[model samples]
Target: MNNLLLNKRIVISGAARGLGLSFATACAKQGADVVMLDILADEVHSQANLLKKQGLKATAWQIDLADASNIKSTIDNVIAHSAQIDGLINCGALATGVGGKNMMDYDEDLWDRVMQINVKGTWLLSKALVPYLKASSAGKIVNIASDTALWGAPNLMAYTASKGAIISMTRSMARELGEDNICVNCILPGLTIVEATAYVPQQRHDHYVNGRALNRKQYPEDIDGTAVYLLSNLASFVTGQNIPVNGGFVFN
Candidate 1:
């Protein structure tokens, strides 16, 4: 544990499992008190307990990003319990089982769901937390996008579009928040091996492996460092950047 984030506090969405849990664990290991938000109440709470048992500072809250009021209430609660939120990692989205549909054939409701949760959710959470973050000395916001958006993966248009929006929004957020010493950035990670990708077809996985210059499966840990670095003082001057962390699958 480098404790790069020592004396810091971070909030992460989708913290029940997969990369969300991994990011939470990684940040906590760096000595940051974490607030893990997810819709899975039992699972998120359980995971937070596990982290606490490891002598890490973690708190879990069940939240639905699609709800604006819920987002506000949750942020208020987080501030009440833990003041001075230093960073936010928007890792929550509707990715599992949301693939396999062609762009033209995508169900209207499904596409809307993706946009509502992935795109609007990121906006809402970031919007609500900016005020608190502005109060911090060095505030950081990291939106977890996808390399699929950059590579233009077929048959996953809705998910890809939603992530693409996040990349764009990160830049705009950074521009507006830069004056306040707050950095907003996006991470376009490759297809990683996690519970969330269980439904992804094997052919897609092979495509990433073969196309990647690294020629290996990407893991959550592979990109966790980028998140940690951005949240730390190392990335104080870096803002409004969309970084691709896909092992050379796509150069962005």
Candidate 2:
């Protein structure tokens, strides 16, 4: 119990599995009351319950990123129950239709769905929660992006583009919310080996691992420390920054 996030109330999207679940558990371990929101209702609830059994403050909610009404209603419900929100981790994203498809061959509907969920969903959720965030003494937002956007990986145009938008939006949000003392930043991860990414091809995984300074694969745990720092008081002065946790894959 490092308690780095003592007394803070944080909300995490896509908290059922993969990086989202990792972040939820990490925050809870640091003494933050976490609200885990995911489309996978049962898995998320079970995860929260497991944390509770460990004597951590954790709750779960189901949400669909594509539905604006659902996002607003879920947030409202969270506020009604949690009363205040101190931080937000936007890890929810649609990465489907991203691999092995060039721009010319990419399906229109798939591209639209990816953008709608990854870009628009992130914006809407942040916009809807800004009020509660502003009410906190130290409000912070961490937008999960991908290093693919920085280096422009091949065959993943839509995913990379949507992440690019997230980086841009993080900058804009930081400037806009600076007046309200809300800090916003983006985290660009490399090819992390999470369950959600288990489908990634072996060659792709090797490419990421071999190109890294660490000469190893990145995992969900590799990102947890930076996330904790960003949401902690230690990073109050840090905003509008894009920090890559990709084991030195792309140096900025």
Candidate 3:
């Protein structure tokens, strides 16, 4: 609403629903031209249409983020659509469902798939988009991480490991991209109750809520301000940092 991002172009992954959609909406409200990428083609296009109706310049692309070749083409298309990209929000993730398996019970294929999408996808997508971000004097990259990566959740080995890699990547990207005036950071979100979490076992949900200082589930809105702040000029001095959007769930 303050027009902090006016005339800027932003790209968000996983913008079909949940936190990613929230980020897209917020950026649009601040007058940013947004391009959303998601595996769910119909849902993403519908959302983009809605944003367009609201007078925001928005577009949608469907792509499998796990493949490096696909990521390169997707990033190139986005850059071609908009002369420059000012920010990127890597909010897409996978491997959130199968958590009850122990080390022995975990399937190798499942583990590999998790790492491929959650870790490799984020890295490749960021790498592919760096050139566009670098073209802008004020560029920012925000990767969405999870609290599970902090303390580590039992039976969630693959998801935790991938998120931990995201945290590490954030710092490394910041260091490498700073010279280009692009700021890279990570956001650690807590138990944000979205449609996806409905599939989570009740016991696990209770476990997360009880551990939080607020003793409540987090909502998509909880991360909005933090996301905007990190991408705004106010955070010009901030880079290689991790800001937990969880309700004090994990103190670091």
TM-score of each: 0.98, 0.98, 0.96
List lDDT for all candidates, in order. Answer: 0.94, 0.94, 0.88
Better of 1 and 3 by lDDT: 1
Which residue runs does candidate 3 get wrong by more than 4 Å? none
lDDT of 3 by residue, 1-252 (tens): 498788888889999999899999999898888889999999999999999999888999987887888888877787677668889999988845857887888999989998889888998888888887888888999999988899888888888888999999999999999999999999999878886667778888888889888888899999988898888888899999988888888898
Candidate 1, position 156, lDDT:
91
Better of 2 and 3 by TM-score: 2
Candidate 2: tens digits of C-alpha lDDT, residues 55-81: 999999999999999999999899889
Query: Candidate 2, which ten residues in sequence have the lowest lDDT sum?
Result: 94-103
What C-alpha lDDT does candidate 2 achieve relative to the native structure? 0.94
The sequence of per-residue lDDT tens digits that candidate 1 reaches over residues 1-252 is 499999899999999999999999999999999999999999999999999999999999989999999999988898899678899999999998788988778899999999999999999999999998999999999999998888789989999999999999999999999999999999999999999999888999999999999999999999999999999999999999999999999997
Compared to the true structure, candidate 1 yields what TM-score?
0.98
Please list the Cα RMSD from the true structure of every candidate, rounded to 1 decimal place. 0.8, 0.9, 1.2
